[model samples]
Target chain A: MDSTCRRMRAEILDISFSSGHGHIPTCFSVVECLYAAYEVMRHDPKRPDWAERDRFVLSKGHAALGYYAVLAQHSYFDIKEVAGFGAYNSRFGCHADRTKLPGVEASTGSLGHGIGIAVGMALGERVAGRQTKVFTLIGDGESNEGSVWEAVMVANNVGLNNLTIIYDHNKSQGRCLPVTNPGERFRSFGCEVVEVNGHNVDALKEVFARPATGVRAVIADTVKGYGCKTLVDNVNEWHRKSPDAEQLAKLLEELHAPAI
Target chain B: MRRQFKETTTALAATDPRVAVVLGDVSVYMFMDFHRANPGKFYNMGICENSLISVAAGMTATGMRPFVHTIAPFLTERSLEQIKLDCAYNQWPVNIVTCGASFDYAWDGATHHCYTDLAILRLLPNMEVLQPGSRREVDALMRATYDSGKPTYIRLSDHPHDVETNLEFGKGTVLREGKSGVTVMTAGPILPNVMAACEDLDVNLVYFHTLKPMDRALVERFRHDRILVVHDAFGLQEAINEVPGLRTWYHGLPDQFCAWYGTVHDIRARIGLDAPGIRKAVTTLLETPSA
Candidate 1:
């Protein structure tokens, strides 16, 4: 894992521990994906509502902590401000609200919605004759929704070469309704499917920067809890769990340790 | 009304570069001219109703005023979450104009019937619900609220009444005044049946096209009277009841699915929404002692 993503994993853990809110495993799954997207996206953190900037929607909205941490890294806001996650009067909620937050394009908590919105944004770009690209990240579990496939089909059929759908294939739904062979599924839906190591920020940045024909789908094969062994091994139990003081220490220790 | 939708929207699109249409493959033929003229702005984007709404919301985010059209039940009911989350909650100005209101698709069976759209959609925060009952009303309301920067729902029915209305978006019309303390309030295309039913009857008549910000001041005017909300759908009575202490009774659909397959008139006649049947309901309400 890159040093920035590892530090973000630590921030996600600290915030989740302090707030006692978040789907930590899910957040861990998409940190690098979110970081990579922002790295390539033409956006100004100061001017999130910049008219001509590229757009990103977190379709798998449960991973908002990860998104927030990554956005904080990008200077959208300070990392310390995210301590109020899921608290009253906090801009950062368990799920993102676009009206409340600066960088959030669409308020998405319900699965399978952001991708469709992203497709529409791409279409809007096409209609306006602008080259503004739109990107969205969807969970493997969220892919179970028929609306996900519905959007995938629409994006391709509309010939949205400006839209890129990043599938967080963390095997989160391996216990039930797994989206087996997501690359094949996206290809079948007429996307330019790119399979990659999700935790590798460089690899993700490469795919995001590369040109495409029609809607692009990046199948980021990822571990549910990437950097920490305890969380990685027991992903199902830690899926929506927040870490305690002692557990937070262990997780941080695991995060900073060299990869085995 | 659909023809008026094409005309009004085509005229709007001629000047307003931001005006676009996203169809769920329901009225592609009707919008052929629109598709030809504004090819980039029009999309007959397959039968996916959910995507139609979400996509329009996306378009709205980009400063485009999108009119998302489809059959009522599929567009409103099936893609309801998309409407609630993407358009309403996100506060996108998506104009959802749907056809096949209530039993307009009567021969297509209960699957095509959509009576819950207005009632359910009005509950969403910052949503505008309009049921235009004539070509004039459709043209008027669409022109007024199409780019109003609010998520608006304009339901167009094939069977529109010819009665000239207030043409205002949220205000109700006082079509008749009577000495009796009974008011027959109805909305949408069923106003003609309601008009014909109450024409000879000694009762006050009221009508509405906007159900969300329902003319509460007008409904309050009849608060002392027995307001019998006569309509073919569930929303008008609920809107009237929003004004407190008014004795309002719904003379609309029952709890059962309208299972029979036939024409809209046949279904309306059977369900006591036709001229004579509505007259009978009004007379029954008037004759019964106030409780």
Candidate 2:
């Protein structure tokens, strides 16, 4: 693994322990993907707020610590702010508050809402004659909301070529994975569905490179706990388990090591 | 009254490129002028109320000022989540204009009557609810809403009526001024009933055109003594509850599905909201002083 990716993983593991919960692991895996993407686009010489820059929204805002850590890696904000996660008057919290955080487009915490907000932003950008692209990451469980489908239909109906919706298909939300396949369901809504290994940084990079002409849904098949060997494949209990001293040491060691 | 809204929205859309009017498959009778003038901006988003509001929210986020027109029930209740999250939560300046307030669709059945819209909307943060009593007031409110730059819900009546007094945003208009015995606060099409009930009585008639802000000064002054609230819908009770130190007697229906029946007059009389019912409630309250 590169130094930047390793550093972000370590920061995510540290912040995940702040809440003393295990949900940080899933957040860490996604952040690793985001950090890798940001690194590739660092010296592209494009405007920071360029109309064509790829946009990302964390639909599952409860895992915002992971997002903030990745943003810090990209120098979107000071890295020191990560320590203030969930602290008094901290912008970084369990859920993303758009009002407080820069580059955080929509204020999302209510499930099944982030995708709709992103669709609006994408449509807005398109209507404004901007060629910018929009990407929103939602939890598989959030698909339970009917508004998600409402957004899916709108995105496809309007031919939102600039929008890409990613599903963090961890297969475990609170207790178990939903019985239905989210990717196929998104396809039914007229989205170009892409199923990829969420942990594979290369795969995510490839998916991000292509903006769908008609809404796209990338089903990122990620494990609930991805990094630490013991917790990597564990689905049910690891959704949110705070790391103990021993577990923390193992996670830190694994993060410092090379890519598996 | 409906044509007035269509004309105002159509005129505004002509000059303003950012103005888009979205309807829920029911603009045929209301928005012919707007469609003729600005074909690209006018969209009938089918019968999907949820999608209509969501699309309007999206349009608002992008810099377009969208006016969404539909029936009161579907606009307020059916797609309530979209209204709360997409518009109120985001604080998008989308004008939600409902054409038939309070039994305008009386014959359409119980599902179309939107008596609970005001009550439900008042609970949302940063949403301004307006119930215009007259055609003039409706036009003035619509014009102001286009420039107000706030998330607003303008509840319009089906029939036309005369504006006894000029109505303003966030301020209740005094239709009949009487001594401080008992004040009757009402809104929308029920204003005529309230006016009739206040004639030759020692009761003040305050018409609450705006529902959300609730005119704190007006409420405080009226709250000094006894007050009787005669709302066309059930949700006005929640608004009255915010005022302190007042004996409030609610004159609306109970919090349940309204039974489908005849006109607004028939439903009002059946549910004890007519001039006679309001007169008796006011007279009874004024005759007896609080302990």
- Sort candidate 2 into its docking category: acceptable
Residue lDDT tens for model 1, B172-277: 8999998878898999999888989998988999999999888999998889998888888878888889888988877888888887989899998998989999
Off by over 4 Å in 1: none
DockQ of 1: 0.88
lDDT of each residue in B131-157, candidate 2, tens digit only: 887778887887777656668888888
TM-score of each candidate structure, all chains considered together: 0.99, 0.90
State residue A134's C-alpha deviation in candidate 1, in Å: 0.6
CA-lDDT, candidates in order = 0.91, 0.74
What fraction of the true Cα-Cα contacts (under 8 Å, chains A to B) does candidate 2 also have?
0.37
Model 2 alpha-carbon miss at residue A208, Å: 2.1
lDDT (Cα, tens digit) per residue for candidate 2, span A61-132: 666767777777666788677677767787776677766776666666777767776876777677677767
TM-score of chain B, candidates 1 onward in order: 0.98, 0.94
